[model samples]
Target: SADETLAHLQAALKRRRRLSDQAQMLVRKAMAYIHSHYTHPLTRQDIAHYVGMSEDYLTHCFRQELGTTPVEYLNRYRVLQARHLLAESDKSITNIALEVGFSSSSYFSRVFRKEVGQSPEEYRRLKQSSVR
Candidate 1:
């Protein structure tokens, strides 16, 4: 009876490890897809389809592996690029927002503020002042 219980536990552990590995691989593929398509307007469904899984499953993998949702990850990447363009180029805030894949400057501002503790305009000004 004890031997049977031990064998069952081992099999369950092996199955869990295999599933974890599979989920990690899926997350990696999803990240790659995000990287390549971050500049385009995308949805969770699109990412899920790209990774050959359901939307819920993809979201779970992202959360489990990266501690973030796919949308947050994409938004962060866009914001990172926007910060660079904001600091280095003379592009208008709206143009920079569009270039960074946000559908509207207003949404971009909200997301940027949430992540950076400031608006995009304020960030650009700060960077400029620091450089000067």
Candidate 2:
């Protein structure tokens, strides 16, 4: 009886691990949508349809695997792109924000500050000062 119980437990554990991997794969696929379309305004429904899953399923996979929602991930990616533009290009903050799919400069600045710990102007000034 003990042997049989151990075998059943092991099988269940293996199944759970396999399901976890599958969920991770789904999350990775969702993340790819951002990478492939970071410059465009993409929606959660768009990503879900692209992956052939419901929006709720995609969101669950993302949160379960990555500990964040799809929008959160997209915001991080957008901020990363903004950082690159700030460092590598002479684009104005508003233009950079719009180009990176943010709806407005104010929202972009808010999210950027939350992630980068500085307003876009401050970030640019700091980086520029370091360069000189």
Q: Give a tens-digit lDDT track for model 2, residues 25-99.
A: 666676777777977888999888887888898887766555567888788889988887898789999999999
Summing lDDT over every window of 10 consecutive residues in candidate 2, give the lowest-scoring window.
1-10
Q: Please give the lDDT score for candidate 2.
A: 0.79
Which candidate has the top score in lDDT? 1
Clash totals for all candidate models: 0, 0
Global lDDT of each candidate: 0.82, 0.79
lDDT, candidate 1, residue 86? 96
Q: Per-residue lDDT tens digits of candidate 1, residues 1-132?
A: 234234433544554453477777777777778778877898999999998999988887777656679899789878988998999999999999998899999999999999999999999999999999
Error of 2 at 9 (Å): 28
User: For this target, which candidate reaches the highest TM-score against the unseen true structure?
Assistant: 1
List candidate 2 segments past 4 Å from native.
1-19
